[model samples]
Target: MELQHREIPVEFLQRLPDGIKIVKRHGKEFMVVEQVLGPGGENLMSDAVHIHGEPSIRLGVRINGQEGLIFVDAFWGGHAKLYSFVPDLAGAAAEVDAFVPETRASLMVNRACDVDGCDCTRSIVLTLPDGKSRVYVCARFGCPGHAIEIADLPPTVSQTISSINFFGVGGSEDDWLDQF
Candidate 1:
């Protein structure tokens, strides 16, 4: 979909932390923290903060800098939390994960923030049971469009391709010919 990006104020950028990037998509903006890790090469979250043992699942929240909304997906109870950023105020912060070569390497990859306003680069495509497909981005947290289906996309947008695709549908003429 076409979106008119607003000029992000300098003050707004100043309020955010380093390594975070601003991305505008479908008419909204989001603040994305790309690389987060757990002890077992999984995403880390508030409730799931532990330095030992690999849990079966990981969790995180997608932050919307504009509205101060934090969107967590089904895994994290599927809710949005309100948070305001104060440049002068210091609070609890995210610490880097245990830095082993393997853990550190895993942290380098983007987890695809699928939130509406986030601009995370990593995405994993999933094919639904009904033969439809979607893309999940922003591994650091959960938000709307974090797990969006291809069929739900606007008409102007024909296909959604990401760095990873669960469905092995090739980019062949037969695979995408009907989309046009």
Candidate 2:
């Protein structure tokens, strides 16, 4: 399926685990977001997100070995239970349970430019721990995933990835992409 690039707000990304990228935003400039991959790793958008005055959008990322059972089942539609798989550490921080609706908001909240002015093309990618990336095109008019339905989305996002404010992470875009 052709993924349509959708715009999202900044606040939505804040709900994630951390280390997610705001990429860029400018006074309501649109941040691109998309459902790009199946599992493991996926980018939030299909292409770059451009706002009129900002440089970031809201999004959380998660991947293999991190997401707990609730997120795993709701997002991937799989029967695997992370909590059950590793019962000893059931209450681990990484194993924190996320409300399905709030989880979907992280992705669907930004359906268009906050001002209804401009929504740019974006790309999404899923990066596995192995250091490989899988790209997906952001949806145009993204599906407003219902709170009840969000329980079925793969929790491939985390706050740790977005909260990464590398002091000397270099000010160049290429510098960041290189790390991914």
The Cα error of candidate 1 at residue 175, in Å, is 43
Supply candidate 2's per-residue lDDT for 19. 22
lDDT of 2 by residue, 59-140 (tens): 3433233543221211111111223233344322221222122334233222222212324233332322233322122222
lDDT of each: 0.31, 0.26
Index of the highest-TM-score prediction? 1
Q: Which candidate leads in lDDT? A: 1
Residue 62 lDDT in candidate 2: 32
Candidate 1 deviant stretches above 4 angstroms: 1-119, 142-147, 152-180
Model 2 is weakest, by summed lDDT over 10 consecutive residues, at 143-152
Q: Per-residue lDDT for 1-72 in model 1, tens only?
A: 211223434543554333234544345453333333333534433344221111112332222322121222
Clashes of 1: 7
TM-scores across all candidates?
0.23, 0.18
